[model samples]
Target: MVADREGGARRKPARAVAVYVAGGAVLLTGCASMPDNGDLRGVESTPRQDTQVRVFAMPPREDAQPSEIVQGFLEALTSDDPQYATAKQYLTGQAAKTWRPELSTMVLADGPATEADPAGVREDSVNFSFTLTGAKVAVVDAEQSYAPAQGSYSRQVRLVRDRKSGQWRINGLPQGVVMGKSDFQRNYTSVNKYYFASNSAVGTASQTAAVADPVYVRRRVDPMTQMVRSLLNGPTSWLGPVVRSSFPSGTALRKGAGPLTPDDQNKLTVPLNGKATQVGRAKCNEMAAQLLFTLQGLTPAVDEVEVQAGGEQLCELDEDGAAAVAARGSAKHPEFLYFIDGEHRLVRIPPGGSRSTNADAVPGELGGGERALRSAAVSRDEHTGAGVALDGKTLYVGSLVSGSSLGEPVVRSAGKTEDERLTTPSWDARGDLWVADRDPEHPRLLVLREGKGEPMEVQVPGLDGQIRSVRVAADGVRIALVVENDDKQSLLVGRIERTTKDVPGGKPGPGSGVSVFELRPAAPALEEVTTMSWAGDGRLVVVGREEGGVQQMKYVQVDGSTPEGPAPDALTGVKEIAAAEDGRLPLVAYSEDGIVRLPDGAQWQTVVKDGSAPVYPG
Candidate 1:
């Protein structure tokens, strides 16, 4: 299976064997009649019973007033119940029926403050508004599209006394739920749902491409089930047109909305509706691959998955098999790191010291004398290389094999001077070369198919800034861009849509290959970004400084959320950063001291004394 670039939709690299525990402990009991012998005299044993407990918040009190009810409802939104049953109790009958918490979510600065004026209050009704004055951090809209929140938000709620029970209840309120930043942190966790590339051809020799759709799920809720159900529901609005799912239309959980349980063997049995029964074995296996990849993030990760339709077994896949079907196309570690060495030649450093240092210039004209490369990018397959000349006016592509000469310039910068010429080059998983000419007059973003075709201009709508750098995600559908406007650099993520027209009996015609993209603001948490690269699983490792601060290295989710895990090591003086889709590879960067890398749990190590423009195969 082909791995999708954006979702890091590749089979996970195989892991080392793990030891097993039975019921969380070892059992060593024997019959007393024979066990009392001297051989067991010194043995000590203890018998213990397993204990389990679950805690849940109590529902709103019956005597609570309108303000108190509103407060409780907002607090309940942070609970672990995915259905928000407790939160609904604070609403009036009609309000509860109309409220759609999933329609959108407002991530507020803090808990809301209720304003109930005496003049606005009647004997049976109270009119008040929840004044939410804090900055909105982010928003999840009705279409499940998550983006950085802008400006402020406020909501008003009116309470009416129930005629039958005399209880104060929320009668009028907003359509979505609102939670403080702290509550959102505690209640929500991000997970990626896997889907096949829209053009993936199943059952053929063609590779399968998988894309990842990241979304937030309720913490402590059954994330496994939520993720699977969300996957079956399909990709969100922005990604819907670029990806495909193996689950058939109308496919749903057979057992209704409930947590999917795994048996003692760690096998999750998913019972689907009848729609899944019609799929063939190969297709069913592909569906299983999606489930396994989505649920792999759960605690006590699922080792196998069993799919059933109408209580009949349809397919089963083990961890290894599922990984094989969704393999990200290559091993997690990169084959080598390529950079411009002191001798002005394209040199390589094999990851983990697998190859000799400063391996001879990638076996071609690029490795020969006077090439004078300024920047370079190696394709994921390591079969091709793209680079920019020292003058930055010409772009070259060449083979990485021994004795192969560099190809003539496929793209030439229109800039009148070298300083305003082309920026660094990047390669996508599809072997497309992307670069931008910095000449303000022309200022164009271009893509060269397979690094050798005619350069095609891609329209980036609403880009009021000059392009600084461009990196395409492995999925080949999204691009991470660093653009500068008014001397301030910003990081942005955009969707790449390829438009083509079918020919009578051939591939897409020349005039049909137009590239268009919609740019969206990303990494709003950072004020200025210098360099960025696509980290595995749709995340980015960025080098930038916060407002009025020094530069630091941090990881940001594609949706603009600051992830909850530990931040990566902070490295200073970084000029460029490159990462492989398989995260096992260390992060390679060009620093003041030279080419440096940060391996997992280790400090930065210098690979070469003088090198620049370090890059890993995409």
Candidate 2:
């Protein structure tokens, strides 16, 4: 820290250690030199008449003596008056003019020095160390205002010098000045004074000589940052319940704006291109439903609320909450868990089953049926608990759990898990199943392949928040997912391409690798589209109301390469769509006074004329 002279401000230069630890001992020893002695009166000086004479002309004899002329120069300049009268006798012209004024306030203390090749004559040189006290001016040009007044003072100074003249003189010594001028100068001025006073108190108050250590500095971390970092660190059993209560169904990317309600059924409409025509009517089976919810994996709770119509309670929902919740079935008491009644509800039923007023109502979990999913397997019996993914030949059930830092998913073969724990599931192109269990402690992505008992796990690096969406690209070269970034609305992409496991303190896990892509498509506009489906070709189809105000269908090709902006019309204007195979167009279904098909004249028969909504690929 240095102080300014004019402004009476102090400036602190952020000092960092550049010394290499490898050869520290040797380097320190080599740099050591004797302190500058103030005895300049006895030293030899540069010859007055021989000043212009070249040394080459004189034959060298023994070693030349230290210059008293140089020594006198130091003593004279360091004096309050600079001994200007005597200095004028040795220096003339420019040299005399520069030091005369500066020397008045320039104060010098003892400095270190070391003579090298003292016995040698040619180009003999000595290194010296010096300490400066009082105030020094520093020039700064930082973005902010400069600090520290010029006239302020400090006692700390450390610098070195290489002197060829045996006599010590400010003119002959290598010198460097530390000062402040601009933004840095202004800020540093206050900072220096503040910290200097701070360090002084600490030095005087504490028993230990160390002024400020990590113990004191560590207190500066903001409380919010620390809390966020903790959750980011891993799953905590103590926090599990709290996290669950806040996010009952975890966090889910829903299709609509309203809270997921019992009547809300997110359907997948497949658009059959080519020559598909509007069919009149055909017998239809009830549609299957899929629900996904996410919480930070902290807390879980169930509460009750009065069911109201225009702010009037038609009836009090069972103690659990709502009486007829879609996922929970017809329960005597329903808590409306996961907002299955309030919002984010996806429910569908077979054609004939819709006749019952409460066919898809929430079921009672009080009879030891539904329980909290807290194990690594994430098993839940209630409809509000977990989800199951079904491909052509197999079904994979999954649920998010919070007992451990590591999320390890359990997979049961199609007919195996009548009473087994479920896990997070996905399907690959070859009809193979993939499961991922998130571990908060270890923070990893666990992948389980079908028929293979032992699963593969890979460590995912610094995930700042709960994982949102995970998808494997068509090329199998990347695993894409949305994770919360610093800003809540935006997401950051984390990619891991290494084929080898790079787990710290352990072997690397298996993975195509992880990489985060920055793009997020706008959610399906539910009013315009009732359902959304991702085609094998990477296209997305939304089924619902299209342009013209009539129920219609449309699709958009995502291909993972779409630039981010307003959602393309082709993607959001669909009523329903389905993907059959690559190169084969997905079938589109909609109802406008009657089931209608775009592109006209292919499959004419319709499933149901007055059906509430059509379910594709159920």
Candidate 3:
């Protein structure tokens, strides 16, 4: 899918309608002018406004039976309540106190089926089990990490009658709630909480890089509180190594602090415990920034955030300040598309060009190198470039600016022939470069840290196919891979894991090794995916053929759902495609006509005539 960006209004071409005429042509004869009816009166109509307020779902009745209570409790889990108060009514006092609804969530494709086993019931208690058989789109864990899930889920619940009230209440059950796809859609909304990049220099003028952590919260349930709480929980395991949260180790919301609500002026006040009171002013500002960026997605955007500790305001930040920080960390893409010309000279096309134009060669030795270049990638900081030589055996890294010369080949293919050579290079937000050597004799995916040292092999378990392409997310946690096996192409998303250890001087250094884990199939409905790019957090733009045998471009959620939006026009004979982490940048692709770009609300425009590979900084 194309990134969402602002553009000029699209002018649709006027269409002509075909009118059918009977044998002799209905409009063959001309008629005289008719007089106006001055006495006719026109009636005025007013639109009816809807004034009915929606009633919230209620808790189970006091006298509800055990079976009815279980059913009601499951249904109540889908309600838009900040605390699931209604759902707790069906649980025993002790059980309710110990239950953690946020521990995990099971998202099933269809409603679950329950069956009661009276034979297992005791004198005052009954037992029941629910059988859910359907596709599991995804699962969210206690850390609010979303992972693609599949297969069936089953669990049991036990209930006993309350001695005084004589109402059935749950005594035992699982920690998290289970809901069907429809209820999940109605009650849960996917949102991203921002965290600063761990390697970002503090107090520096450089833009602070923000990583997006996507999670689902109850719809209409105090999203401001939900987002802040999730942010405090810290980044997920996959992201923890790459991003850092502002909240201190022991910091937490003040006791008795209920759901947070904004005032009429769009100002929100957050109360923290004593752990936050010891933090300095700059740290307090960082904490407020986390809240401001997370709350920007609310229906009525929050304008300002005030953080307090010990009943005293510690720091406050407005939307403008928070926006500046976010913008500063954002990736600044280059103003041109660079590629190898016919003479193997690195050339570039200026941004927003209507057609291909001759521009100066890329600065430095790369532009004048003797080795023919096949593909290349620019770094997110736009300070370096990685290129694959035309022979497909050598990988070169060099400065993007004018004065510096290209370095020696950093990686070489181990394949016996040209077919098993290096693929296109890709960069991650952490400044790591990734590429796959498709040598059949020694197939492996390698990562080069800042283009230094020997490329390390990344373990990809259960991958029996030939690696075709690799694209890493800007967050440096997830990777998109296109693999071909048995003449079929599969698009998979995997989580990257890195282990760090303390070095001699107590500095943290790379641990044993890096590996990719929990590989899951995405865009499963597509038959043959040829290319893909990370369009946004937890979202991808894929080019593939559907079951009907038609090639198309569409957006697919990481959970295997196709997002609702207009698909970009299909490009025939497209060689490659690239997108920036920021959704506001346009999409560029290397097609038969040259380097073509799809600007917001605009059709494809050729930016360079002879370019083969077009890319933006990761």
TM-score of each: 0.86, 0.23, 0.75
Of 1 and 3, which scores higher on TM-score? 1
Candidate 3 lDDT by residue in tens digits, 89-144: 88889999999998887776554444455343345543433332334656778876
lDDT of model number 3:
0.68
**Which of candidates 2 and 3 reaches a greater TM-score?**
3
Model 3 scores a TM of 0.75
Highest-TM-score candidate: 1
Instruction: Specify the poorest-scoring 10-residue window by lDDT in model 3.
Output: 37-46
lDDT of 1 by residue, 1-618 (tens): 000111121212111112223544322211212210011011111112222211133365666555455545655565445576767888887888999998887776544434444444356553443443445778877655567887767556666777778777778888887765655665667777878776632122345666777888766567678777788888987777778888999999986745787889989989998988889888898999888878875455588899999889999998777766664432346678888988777878776633245555777777675588888888877888888898899989998887887757988887988868998888776677899999989898999767876788888878879888888877777788988888888898887777766578645566665454667766776678889988876788999988898999888877788777777787779988877777778888888878888888788887777888888876
Give the alpha-carbon lDDT of every model: 0.71, 0.25, 0.68
In candidate 1 the C-alpha lDDT for residue 86 amounts to 69
